[model samples]
Target: MTDFVQSARHTTEALRDLFEATPLQRNDHLSARYGAEIWLKREDLTPVRSYKLRGAFNAMRKMRAARPDLGHFVCASAGNHAQGMAYACRHFGVRGTIFMPVTTPQQKIDKTRTFGGAAIEIVLTGDYFDQTLAASQAYCRDQGAHFLSPFDDPDVIEGQASVAVEVLDQLGRAPDLVILPVGGGGLASGVTRYLRAAAPGTAFRFVEPAGGASLRAALEAGAPVTLPRINSFVDGAAVARLGTHTFDALKWADPAQVLLAPEDRICITMLEMLNVEGIVLEPAGALSVDVLPVLADEIRGKTVVCVTSGGNFDFERLPEVKERAQRYSGLKKYFILRMPQRPGALREFLNMLGPQDDITRFEYLKKSARNFGSVLIGIETKQAGQFALLAERMNEAGFAYRDITGDEALAEFLI
Candidate 1:
C-alpha cells in the first residue's frame, strides 16, 4: 500500500480506541425508491454526531506526537468543525480556543461548549465565518498556537481517509459507487484518495450544495476560485472557495462526476429522511442522498454508498425546512393579488380555491386603497398543478395577481 493509504489504515485502527466504526447500513427506503442497493455510511452516529471528529482526532494526535510542547490548538467554525475540535481537544487533554461567528445558532455553540468542557475556551467573534476565521488565525499567531484548519491540511485529509478505511472494512468489499458530500473537500478528497487505492474499481460521485459548489467551480476553473457569493443555509458545506490542499488531491475529478444539489431541494431530502426513515439530517448531511435521484439510471441495481455526513440538526429549523421543501417541490406558493374594494371580494377569492388548496398565510400589503388593495397570500396544495388551475380561475375572475414564490428578491424580504 502507498504511504498515505497505510497511514489512513493505521489511523482508522487507532480511532477504535475513541469510538467504534460508524454503521454502514443498507437503507431499504432509499433502495426501493432508487432501484439500487443504497447504503448510508452513518457518520451522523459518531460521538460528535459527525465524521468531523475522525479528522480532528487524527490531526490532533499526529500534531501532539510531533510536537509534545504544542499545548494549545485553535480553530474557527460555526458548526460541526467546532464541536469536532472541542471533542478532540478534550480527548487529547490539550487546551483549545474555538472562534465562532456571533450569529451561530445557540444549539451549535452549546454543543461545542459541552464537547470541550474545561479543555477549551469559546470565542464568539465577527458576523460571518470569514471574519471569525481571520480573528482565529490572528489569535493563533499572537498566542503561538497551532491553528487547525477544518479541511485544508494534509494531516487532516489523511485523517479523514479513515472513513473510507472503515467503510471498506465494514462492507467487506467495494461498493459499486460511493457518493460523497463535498465542502472544503476534506472528507471527499480523503475518502476518494483512499478508495481509489484500496478499492480501485469503485466509482465515485461528488455532491455539493448548489449555492456553494466550490468543487464544481474548481473543476471548471482548473483551480480553486472564490465564489462571488455563497448561501450559507447549508452551513456545514457552504464554502466560498475550495481548500488549496483539498483541490490538489481532487484536481483530477471529472466535472461531470460532480453534482450540485440545490439548497432548497435538500430540504425535501431532510424532511423525507426525518418523516419516513426517522433519520434527521442537517442540510449538508443530506447532500449525497439528495443527489441520488439525479443518478438513478446510473446506479440502478448497483450497490451505492451515500455518506450521511452529520446529524446535528436543530429542531427549531423544522418549520423553515418544511417551508423550503414545499416551495421547491411546487406544493406551495406565494402571490400578491390586487383586489377590488368591494364587499365580499375576499369571499370571491376564497371561493376560487380548490378543495385541496389551503391558505397557509394571508396578509394585506395595503388594506385600504381607493379602488384596489394588495393582498399577500401563501397557498399550499396537495398537487403542484393546482397553481395553474388557480391562476386560470383568477384570470377569468378579473383578478390581477403576481406570483412571487419564485421571485428571489421579493421572497427574501417578504417570504
Candidate 2:
C-alpha cells in the first residue's frame, strides 16, 4: 500500500477514539431535483459540527505521541478550527490557548469554550484574523508551546485525509464525482490526494465563495496569493489566501473545475436545505449543494457526493439569510422613491402596489426636503413576476423611484 493510504486509514481508525465517522447519506431531495444519485457526506454531524476535528485530533495525537512532555498547544481561528482544537485538547488532557477575532459571533466563542472546558483558554483579540493569527504565533513562540496551523501543517493534512478513507469505505466504490468546498484548501487537498491514490478514476469539483476565490487565484498566479478583500458572509470558507502547503498539494487542480458560489445565491441554498430537507447548514457548508444546479447537466444520472462541511450557524442571522434569499429570487425589492410633499401623495403611491406586494419597511425623510421627500420602501411579493408589475405600475403612475436591491453600496448604506 502507498504510505499515504496506510497513514490515512490508520488516522481514520484512530479517530474512533474521539468520535464515529460522520454519516454518508443518500439525499432523496437533491437526487430528485438534479436527476442524479446524490449523496451528502455529513461533516456537519461531527462533534465540532465540522470536519476540522479530524485534522485537529490527528495533529495533536502525532505531536503528543512523539513528545510525551508537550502539554501546551496554541491556535488562532475565527470559527470551526477553534472548536475542533478545543475538543481535541480536552480529549488529550492538555492545556490549549485559542485566539479568535473580536468580531466573532458569541455563539461560536461560547461553543469553543464549552468544548475545551478547563483545558483551553479563549483569547479575544484583533478585529481582523491576521492580527489574531500574529498574536497567537508570537504567544506560541514566547511560551514555547506547540502551534497548530489550521490548514498549513503536514500532520493536519494527513489527518484530514481520513475523510477520503471513510468515504471510500462507506460508499464501497468510487463515486463518479465528489464535490468539495475550498477555503485554505486543507480539506480539498487531503481528500483529493487520497482519492486519487485509492479510487484512481473519481472526478472532483471544487466550490469557493465568489468573494473569496483563493484557490482559483493561487492556480492562476502559480503560487498562493492574498486577496485584498473578501466577503466574510461564508466565514468558514472565505479565506483571503490558500496556505502554501495546501496550494502545493492542490496546484494540480484544473481551474475550470473550480466554481464560485455568490454570497447572495448561497443563501437560497441554505434556505432550501433547511426548509425542504431539514438540514441546518452554515453558509460555507451550503457551498457544495449550492452549485449542484449549475452542474445539473454534467451530474445528471451519475453518482455524486457533496461534502456539507459545517452546521455551526448562529440563529441570529436567520433574518438576514431569509432577506438575501428573497432578494436573489426576485421576491423582494427596495426602492428610493421621490414623493411630493402634498396631501394624499402617500396614499396614491401606496395604491400603485399590487395585491401580492407587501411593504416590509418604510422610512420617510420629511426633514431632508421641502417640496419632495425621499422615501425608502422595502417590498416583498409572492412571485418574481409581481416585482415587474409593481415597477410598471410605479412608472405608469409617474412615481420616480430607484431599485436599490441589487445596488450593494446603496443597500449597505441604506438597507
Query: Number of the top candidate by TM-score?
Result: 1
lDDT tens string, model 2, 1-415?
A: 3898899899999999999999999999889998999999999999999999999999999999999999999999989999999999999999999999999889899999999999999999999999999999999999999999889987888988888998889999999999999999999988998999999899999999999999999998999999999999999999999999999889999899999999999999999999999999999999999999999999999999999999998889999999999999999999999998889999998887888889999998464787899889999999899888778988888889999999999999889
- Residue 358 Cα positional deviation in candidate 1, in Å, after optimal superposition: 1.0
Error of 1 at 63 (Å): 0.8
The collision pairs in model 1 are none
Q: What is the lDDT of residue 65 in candidate 2?
A: 94
> What is the TM-score of each predicted model, taking all chains together?
0.99, 0.98
Q: Which parts of model 1 are misplaced by more than 4 Å?
A: none
lDDT at position 167, candidate 2: 88
Query: What is the number of backbone collisions in each predicted candidate, taken in the order shown?
Result: 0, 0
